[model samples]
Target: MKQLISYAVAALSLVATQAAAAPVTYYIQSEPYETVSNFTACPLGGCTVKYAKSNRISGSITLVAPLGSNLTDEDIDLQIHSFSISDGQNTYTDAQFFVDVFAQSARVSTDSAGNLTSFEFKFDKTHGTPYGEASYADSKAKVSYIWISSAPSPGAAVAASNSTCQFRGDNVNGNTNGAGCMMAYDTDSQGASSASTTGVTMSLTPPPAPTPVPTLSEWAMILLGVLLTGAAALNLHRRRQTA
Candidate 1:
């Protein structure tokens, strides 16, 4: 009987472990858009006064890992198990976006001392057009990219020495894409332009509220019921033996 009870408890333990859910979250707060620089220059195509802008967006980007998977701080490139964005009003899921943002593009960077330097999240939709090829798209398929770093500061020219500023996830082959983490939300034929920013803050999302545990009295009641059932079974076994 003791052995049987032990086996049953072990089975319950296995089931609980299998049914458990583990998720990781990252919190992102964006800075307002601002002008980075302005200069008068004549390009090869035409003459114009050009300026650069940093990335700034108003929304919450939530990233979740796959079930049964373990994600650690040391993991350089992370899989985009689940992705969503909430723009203070509506939330958009991965299905709404034309591109699969999870193809090993999400990454975290650290310094030599293993201190977190910065991290970036890249996702965009070009209305079925191959990413990077779509200069413009509809609202549902608009292209969007977000990058938040620690160095060079927002609205400042990207530091050449700041190697961690690169966004090489989905777009590989040394594509210098998503520079300065500039965000664009334009839905016109002219295409969206990157925006400048004052600064952005990032941190680990707080853990969800913990489930309440049973009180000692409740646990005692459960234990008493189990003991009674076991005792009844033992008593029946003894009677059978006597007969």
Candidate 2:
């Protein structure tokens, strides 16, 4: 009977550990977008140019991995949760854009200890932007907007003239055509704001660890109760024997 009880307790503990080790989702949130000030732009003829502006951008992405997985060695799926860009005069939300087809190469790099080091990806506004690219190499990440559109709504299809590329790291087999490095800057058609050449700091937040099922203390309490109940039954048996 004691052996059976021991086996049951061990099984429960193993189950708990396995449950706690299950994969988890993590969130990487972009700090509030910086406002690009003293910005200037010229139209086609270069005669009239817009001057001075401010803009704000915000968004977050999600990645998944085992609770203790080494992110540096993991090729995780990337999902963009929310994004927005504003020109101080006009604002746009993620609904107005889509992750480029090459987004599959979007990746995160981390130290061997699982600390994030850098991340990179490209996305385009729905109307006609070739690509909005960002790469993290140092303490800050730099972002560049190839082009932007004036579409006021989200979920709109990419314009026929729109072009984009996959990250160069994703251009497997030394193929460079249509790779991210080929992307070129273009004049914004609708005056959508562009991020400054300076870097934008981003923060990554991991999901809280799952609460262990039947914590060690709780298991001890459960074991104590079972032992007490068994003792009580044994005492009752002794009383009946005496009777």
Where does model 1 exceed 4 Å of error? 1-21, 36-78, 86-92, 97-104, 110-117, 127-144, 152-191, 206-243
Across residues 12-88, which tens digit of lDDT does each residue of candidate 1 receive? 99977655433444555555346433222212111121223333343344434321223233333333434555322
For each candidate in the order shown, give its overall lDDT on alpha carbons.
0.40, 0.37
- Which ten contiguous residues of candidate 1 have the minimum total lDDT? 157-166
What TM-score does candidate 1 reach?
0.41
Runs in model 2 lying further than 4 Å from the true structure = 1-55, 66-105, 126-182, 189-192, 197-243
Model 1, position 19: C-alpha lDDT score: 50
Residue pair clashes in candidate 2: 95-154
RMSD each, Å: 20.8, 21.0
Cα deviation of 130 in candidate 2 (Å)?
Answer: 12
3, model 2: CA deviation in Å?
7.1
The best candidate by TM-score is 1
Candidate 1: residue pairs that collide: 34-196, 54-195, 54-196, 55-182, 55-183, 105-169
